[model samples]
Target: MRAGHCAPGWNVTSMKDIEHPIPVRIAYVGGGSLNWAPTLMADLAHDTRLDAEVRLYDLDPAAAERNARMGGRYAEVSNGTPARYRAVPSPREALEGADVVVVSILPGRFDDMAQDIGIPARYGIPQAVGDTVGPGGFVRAMRAIPMLAEIARAIGEHAPNAWVCNLTNPMSVLTGALHAAFPGIRAWGECHEVTKIRRQVAGIANADAGSDRWSFRDVEVNVLGINHFTFVDAISLGGRDMLPAYRAFAAANASGVNETVPGEDAEHDRYFGSKCLVKFDLYDRFGIPGAAGDRHLAEFLPVGDYLADPGRWGFGLTPVEYRTRDQARRRARAEALAAGEIAPVAKRSDEALIDQIVALAGGGTFVSNVNLPNRGQLAGIPEGAIVETNALFSGLGITPLVAGHLPEGLHDIIADHAARQSALLQAVMAGEGGALFPLFHEDPLVRHMPETEARRMFGEMIAATSAWLPENLKGAA
Candidate 1:
C-alpha cells in the first residue's frame, strides 16, 4: 500500500485483491498538522474493516504537507493500512469525493480575539472573556458564518453525500448555518465537551475506568439550549436515576481521578475543578450540574450575577487567547520537530468515540449529540429549531430523541438562550449587522447594563473585531 497520491481507477474491487476493500476517504480542513486528524486516521487504519485515506487541506500548504507526512508515517508504523495523503490548498479539491469533511478552521485565529477583548476592555466593558459569550462571540460568529457557509456550499457542490463533522467553536452557530443554508447536506457539529462531562460524572460516581461501569452506552443525559449553555436535565444509568449521585459529587467536592480523560494538566485542572462554582449553584437549585461552565455559564446566568463582581469570580482569558496560546506552543514544538531537534510527538492509537458514530452511520446505527432540527426532539423547543440530544443512527438514518417536556424552570431558561442564539445564527446567515446588537443585549453579561451602555459596548467590540468580521459588519461598526 503506497502513501501519498493514488493513481486513478484503483477501484474497491481492485483494492480487494490487497486486503481491505472499502476505503473511507476523510477530508480535514484546518489544524491539519494538529494531533487530532493524524491520531484519528491512525486509529481508523488499524481496523481491518476500514481502508482510510486522508486528504488534508489548509490555507498553509506547508502545514498541510507536514501533517500529511506525519499521518502517513503513523499509518505505516502502526497498522500498515494502505493510507494515502494529499495536501490541496484548494478546499474544493480537498473536499471532492470525501466521505466525511471535518471542519476545525479558526478564520482569524487569536490575533483577532486579542483585539475583541482588549478594545472592549478599553471601553470599560470588561471582557476578559470572549468566544462563548459577550460581543466577542457575536463578532466571532460573524467572521466564521460566511466561511462555514462557503464550506457547506462546497460540500453540496462537490460531495453532496459527505457527512460534515464540525469541530469549531460557536459550534451551534456554524452548525445551524449549515442546516439552514444547505438543507440537503448531512452535517453535525462535534464537541468533546459532553464526552468529557460524562467521564467526569463516571469519576464522581467512583466507577472503574477500565470497564463498562461508566460507559456512555445507554446512559440518558439531556443537553438543551445552545452549545455552551446546555444543562443536564436528566441522567440515568441502567434505568436507575443517577442525578442524586451526580449532585452529591458536585456538592461534596469529591476528589477522584477522572477516568475518561488521559491527562493531568491545566486543561484537566480547569475541566475538573474550575467550573465548580456554577455546578454548585445549579446543584443547589436544579439538583444537577450545568453541562456548560465558566464563560458559557456566565453567558446563561442573569446579567446581575455575572456583573456583580469579577474580582471574586476572577475573569479568565477569552477562547481566542486560550486557543492562540495553545497554537503558538504547538507551533514552537513543531519548529523543533522541523529542525530535528525534537522527535515528532509519538502517535497514539485510540478510537475516537465520534468515529465510532461515523462507523455506525455507515453500518446503520447512529448515536451522537447532533445539532439538527428539533422536529419534536424536545417538547418545549420550537419544532424546527436546532437542539442537541442523543440520536439513534441506523442504516435507515439518524433519529434525534424527542426529549419529553423539561422542567419548566430549565425549559424557560434554555428556550430564552436558544431563541437568542438561533436569532444570532440567522442574522449571520443573512449578513444582518443590526441583529448583532440584539444578540449582545440578550447576553447574560450585558443584560443588566443600561441600554445605552450595552449598545456602546456592542459598538466598541464590533469596532475591535472589524479586521476579522464580514464587510457588512465592519461597515456597521
Candidate 2:
C-alpha cells in the first residue's frame, strides 16, 4: 500500500523493472457504468504493483470514452502509480489478449427496472432491492442471462484462458450462465456483502472480549450458500472463537429497532443503509449469521419481516423514482470528472477485484470467498449450481474449499433458490420464456397469492419490461 511498493503478493520481486517491464492487461465490461467504473479507475490509480492497461467496452461508446477521459485525469492528478485506461468498441477487441475480465452491467434501462419492481409491488409483494431476489430478481435474471452468455462466448473466442470476475447482481445465475456458455471458461463472482459482516463481527468481538490485535482482515470465516443470501457458520479471530460474543450481541439487539448504523451518517438521503436489524432477526430464528446486508436479506425472507412496510424497519426500500433522478446526478458528476472540472477521488475500494487478478497472475496464492460451481464445496446444493464459498486462488487454479452444509432450518429456503436459479438458467438459454411460470409461481412472494392473480401479475410484468426483453421472452406467458 505504500508508495513505490509492488502490489501485495508473494514471491514477486522487481515487478516494475523499467527495462523489459511486464504488462498486465485487464478487460472491463460495462466500462460506461458511472457507479462502478469510477471506483475502478480510482482504485487502479493507486495500485502501484499491477500497472495494467485496462481496455474498456460498453454498449454506449460515448459513455465509455468519458470514463476513459476520467482515467486519464487520474494519471494527471495522482502523484502515485496509475493504470492506463482506454475505450474499445467491441467485446472481442477489449478481451482479445486480456489477463482478466471484470463485469458490472445494467441488464436493461432504469425504466425496465421500474417495471421489475413496480409490477411486483402491485401484486402485494415487497422487495427492498429488486435485482437480487423476489419476483423482480427472477425476471431480471431472464433478461441478464443471455447477454452474459454472449459475453462469455466472446471471452471463449478471444481470451479463453482469462479469469473472469462478475460483479453483476443476480450474480449466481449470471456467473453460472458464463460457465454454461463456455464450459472451459474460468469464471467467479465476487461481492463485498460478506466483508461488511466481517467488519461488524470484529467490532462486536473486540468490544466484548478485549481481543488481541484484530481487524476485519483478521476475522476468518467458513462461508456457505449463494451470493446475497450467504451465511457464516463459524468465525474466529487470531485462532480464537468469536461466536459466543456474537451470540450475546445478537440476543441483545435482535428484538430492537435500529434506525442508523454505527458508522454511517443518519441525515443523508441514504438509498442503501442498514443497522443489521434484519440480520440479527434471522440469527435469532436460524442460529446462523446472515452475511449480506439487511435490505438484501429481507428480500429472501417472508414479506412480513422487513419488506411489508420497509420504512418501519431499519432499512427502507429504495424507490425507483429516486434511482431515476440519481442517474442524471451521476452523469453530471461523470462529465465534471471527465472534463477535469473537478478532481477525481483517489480512495480505493475494499473490493477484491485487484487482489483476485494479482493472485490469478501467479503473483501469489490468495484465499477469499468466491461464487463458483458446487463441486462439493457446499453440501445439499446441487452440483454445478453457482454457490459462494471460501476458495484458494493461485497459479495452479481455483480450488474451492469444502464449506460443509446449510443448517437444517435454512435448508429448504437456500436450496430452493439454487433450484430456481438453475431452472431460470435453462429457460433463458433455450429461449423458453413461457416455461418459467412454474418457478415464478413458486417464488416466495408469489406462492401465497391466488393462482390467477399470480399469473396475471406475471404476464403484466413481462409486458411492462418487454422493451429490453427478446421477442421470445416478451409476453410469452
Indicate which candidate wins on lDDT: 2
Any runs in candidate 2 off by more than 4 Å, and if so which?
1-22, 77-80, 205-214, 255-269
Q: How close is candidate 2 to the true structure, as a TM-score?
A: 0.91
Predicted candidate 1 versus true structure: per-residue lDDT over 39-118, tens digit per residue: 56556555455566778888888888777766655555444455677778788888888887888787575777776666
> Number of the top candidate by TM-score?
2
After superposing candidate 1 on the true structure, give the runs of residues whose Cα lies further than 4 Å from its correct spot: 1-22, 31-39, 42-49, 80-82, 122-129, 207-220, 238-240, 254-261, 267-275, 306-322, 334-357, 364-366
Query: How much lDDT does candidate 2 score?
Result: 0.80
TM-score of 1: 0.83
Which pairs clash in model 1?
364-394, 364-395, 365-393, 365-394, 366-393, 377-403
List the candidates' TM-scores in order.
Answer: 0.83, 0.91
lDDT against the true structure, per candidate, is 0.62, 0.80
